[model samples]
Target: MGWSTKQIPSLRGRRALVTGANSGLGLQTALELARAGAHVTLACRDAGRADGAVATIRDQVPDADLEVRALDLASLASVRALAEALDGEGAPLDLLINNAGVMATPERRTADGFEQQLGTNHLGHFALTGLLLERLKAAPAPRVVTVSSGLHRIGRIDLDDLNWERRGYKRWGAYGQSKLANLLFARELQRRADAGDLALRSAAAHPGYSATHLQTAGPGQGGGVGDRLNALVGRVGNVLLATSDAYGAQPTLYAATHPEVSGGAYVGPTRLGQNRGPIGEVPSTRAGHDREVARRLWERSEQLTGVAFGLPAAEPVAG
Candidate 1:
């Protein structure tokens, strides 16, 4: 009785690009979209793994239309490269799923000198979406679905030190900040689209504790006994407490293809602290809806990434 992949309408002729589509949630999202008749480009950091994912999806959907493209989100040059490649093709992009991200990890910085979590999870997607604005606008109805996390509830944006330059970094807090930035970015993007009278829909979704490598990838980086133990715990939690990645991808799929979903909508599971259950629109933190903060973050994102959305600014409030 609940909404599932069965509810996904035919996606024939639509062109989709899913970041981090080599495995887990992104892979599932790509597979389902391909099954629904979309031509999907699996944008990933590892070409081999992406090929493996493509083979796996082909095993299930023999006629699935898919391609692999290299994308390393931590580097702005890589982001620009992928965008430029797509732009040169002069094809309309119907769906852009900003699903690839990093979690809590030992302190690391991206090639752009940004903290790893924020850079990969937030800034990378920011630049990619902005760069792809024209292609998305070309579509009859373009949708941008960004994947955030429930952990975003605990996040606070430190506009003064987004890259961990001014203070000590707690990995989890840094991850939270990045995820919060995702929500704000999605909503702010929608606001700008509406202000500019563009037919672009920007929405955000959370997977709600999906069993994926995301949990272990960060901790495993340290390669120490404690890190190994943490990875083990993450695996254990995945088995015991998390939903399958297929189930987890529903919120994103819903946001991406569902006609009823609107700009600025946030989707997630509807039960158990939003960790697992049927998909539905969900509430976000009050900060998630703060217009001024979203505006400031938008401007800051442009400055940091050197990528601009080129949309009109939010209108002055009628006070």
Candidate 2:
């Protein structure tokens, strides 16, 4: 009756790249896109898992156009390599889904010495987007959909302690910061596109407590008690409040394919505190729409990730 994944328009000729597509929301998003006739690339850290996801999608759609590619979001080098590889292919990317992320976990640093959550959740995707900007622009109506979280409400971008070097890191706080950065990045990207007259559109979405392995795989993907607790709570909470991975993926799918979606718009569940429901437009936080903060975050992200997005000239608007 209402707009659902099945209602999404056909994407017959579109090519989509979805990060963390091996499981959970990412996998569901990728499969749905493929089912809608888009050729999907499953970008994941584990080649085996990516292969499995491709297999699963093929099993369902039978003729689904899918590919598995390795992408470790925690590593800048990996992001760069992936971008370069995609660019070398010279294929137009119609959709870019910044879906892979890490959740609350113990204090730790990535190979680049960034807080693990921030590194994988924000920086990795930041760099990847920058690298793929040209390919996105090559498309007729490209869209970049970044997945954020409700925890962003409590997040404050600590420029002085971005890496959690000066202050002690709290797992939830770090996760919140990363998720908040996601929203800011999407907004800033849209602003930049408008200013520079880029054809690509940027949008953000969040899964309302979808049951995923993020909690379990996140905390201990590096191995620790924090991982155990994260996984345990995620599993338990999933039973009580979390929705199915399919339902959880609705927001992202909507953001990616909805023709009415605008740049800088945020999408998520439309009911019950935004934790679970049908995918629809939702109000974004004031902070999420702060142009100044978005600009500053963009500059900081460029500096931190060393990936510059070269935007085109802006179209002048009549006053």
Candidate 3:
């Protein structure tokens, strides 16, 4: 439980749902979880990509119990549909991994007309988690592991412009905001669950400086000089500073299955600056645990996504 992937207990008989499991970190997370004996649902946007991911994992784990499903986090309709379908399966979902996200993309809106990063990264997963709460609660020691980022330290939440409608978008800034929301939601969920005495826990993790395709996944998807430049720079940085996606996944896996990790806890690389190393509980931004901000953000998310989590109101706490 201190800092090793080998510490992950057997996940047999567990059902895990991993969003954006088509490629990169999400795929790596799913592959490992499947190898660990959990039945994994690969919730991805593209069917072809999902199929490929499943094949790749099966090649390794041969009989890996896996299912491919469609999910586009940008659309609330898709989130609801996926949740409903999974709920209909009549099995407890032991783990909900909200790992899908876009990063450093050009300005664009989602199907819901919100900024792309915030829409997919925060709101989409927010709504999905809420919709699936029932299935999660049916399982023993059910957990929610939302992937956040170290960049959240520099992020600011402008609740008024959560989607940057009034203010113009800065891609990294917007990405930061969404990442901040990930941590806030994770911690707030844990707080609410504890207050209600529910047997559920939520935690967040970050794959610090992982060399995944994520850094370049979004920039050029919009087709612009700046977008291309961002992608190039990101790729360069990945080559120079990022760790392997396999290693990148340890913190996430640790948080998801490690028995010692408590609700509201954060797991990250244990080295200096928490950039890349062993997985362990690391210090996160104080703002991530800001009570007033978390409470307001939770309410606003409920209003925006229209997925009400019938938990008690969050109580204020000093940071």
Judging by TM-score against the true structure, name the best candidate.
1
| Sort order, lDDT high to low | 1, 3, 2
RMSD of each: 1.0, 2.5, 1.5
Q: What range of 10 consecutive residues in model 1 has the weakest lDDT sum?
A: 310-319
Model 2, runs deviating above 4 Å:
220-230, 312-319
lDDT (Cα, tens digit) per residue for candidate 1, span 1-319: 6789988999999999999999999999999999999999999999999999999999999999999999999999999999999999999999999999988898999999999999999999999999999999999999999999999998999999999988898888999999999999999999999999999999999999999999899867788898898888898999899999999999999999988997899999988999877898999899899888889999999999999989987885676
| lDDT leader | 1
The whole-model lDDT of each prediction reads: 0.95, 0.88, 0.90
lDDT of 2 by residue, 1-319 (tens): 4569988899999999999999999999999999999999999999988888888888999999998888999899899999999999999999999999878867878888889999999999999999999999999999999999988988888877888998877888898889989999998888888888888789999988888887566565546665666677777887887888999899999999998998888999988999765678888778777666667777888899999887642333355
Worst 10 residues of 3 by lDDT: 1-10
Q: Can you give the lDDT of residue 222 in candidate 3?
A: 75
Q: Which tens-of-lDDT digit does each residue in 1-319 have in candidate 3?
A: 3466566778899999999999888999999899889999999999999999999999999989999999999999999999999889878999999999998788899998889999999999999999999899899889999999999987899999999999977988999999999999999999999888889989999998998888888765677788788789889988998898888888889899888888898889988789866788888888987878988999999999999989997567656
lDDT of 1: 0.95
The TM-score between candidate 2 and the true structure equals 0.94
